[model samples]
Target: MGESAKTEETAALSVRALDDETWPAFARLVEANNGVWGGCWCVGFHVKLGKGRTAAENRAEKEQRVHEGRTHAALVFSDDECLGWCQFGSPEELPEVKSRRLYEKGLVTLPDWRITCFFTGKGLRGRGVANAALGGALAKIARLGGGTVEGYPEETDDRKVSGSFLHTGPMVAFENHGFTRTRPISPHRWVVTRTVAPA
Candidate 1:
């Protein structure tokens, strides 16, 4: 590939905030995952899971939220194709934590935003898409005037876990971006945070 082509390829790894105009790309990424979280359409964090809710219903609810501009995410794009996304919002927006008890153990500070979940396209693993999505989310948060951002990421310590289970993303993803652990929210998941400054 020529230098310009290589540059373009590198440029393709970019981040954009989720909005109505960009919803299509986000939907495409989720659809590729068999509707992510069992056709959740990325609403798993926004609302509590019921005993028996249809995937279509969940999808509709999610769409409605997005349509009303009540959704948020940071999309990672490779050229024109969205390859991954990291969901984020205020603490009230994503109030539930996987391990509620542990999360409450060390609540020294209240957060302005929470990094909840992530999804990377199939066959695009190990391409740094998750990291890009995280960077994008942080950039967006900073643009939102900068504040405390929280995340619950699973730590890897010689034990292997599937990326699918790491919906909140890996520990290193937050660490590399200046996040510090506040407490262990689960056996492998920890509550992490970072304070960003607007660019």
Candidate 2:
């Protein structure tokens, strides 16, 4: 079977927290999808932990962040292979992210969580991988007794932005999943939220 066929066959995949044993596969996924975020390893916001660091250094820091449980980002997987990732956690837990203009909006006065980044393997883009990842994240959040989930997606008129930089995801993706635009940080970015009522 071809790659696309293999992906389709494994579409019933699930999301899980990454641990020491799974780090290598997760790192490979980020490296393979680096084209999406310029080889970010989803460290755009976590770079503050080691400012002025080289990409290699920042990557190591991010790996340490995951291993230390200082932050939490989920990995999408088919059996044991990593296919994608979603970064989410309390914004304050990510000092670099809090310093960005993207999060300056007054929306986060309280302890709101941020879903700051996403990625899928090169051949896996536009196949609803993100939606599946979001669904898995939401379920994970719910199991944690839930809290408000927020994202800052770009408001793009043209869809040609590179995937590496498109971590915010399109507005439609959030809207489709019951998230609403709380405000627009810029013409190209929006603060979207889904408040989970106390249970």
Best by TM-score: 1
Write one digit per residue (lDDT tens) for candidate 2, span 27-51.
Answer: 8876666533444567777655344
Pairs that clash in candidate 1: none
Candidate 2 has a TM-score of 0.82
List CA RMSD, all candidates.
2.6, 3.6
Candidate 1 lDDT (Cα, whole model)? 0.84
> Which residue pairs in model 2 clash with each other?
36-163, 36-164, 37-164
Best candidate according to lDDT? 1
Distance from true position, residue 12, model 1, in Å? Answer: 2.3
Off by over 4 Å in 2: 1-10, 33-36, 49-52, 98-105, 197-199
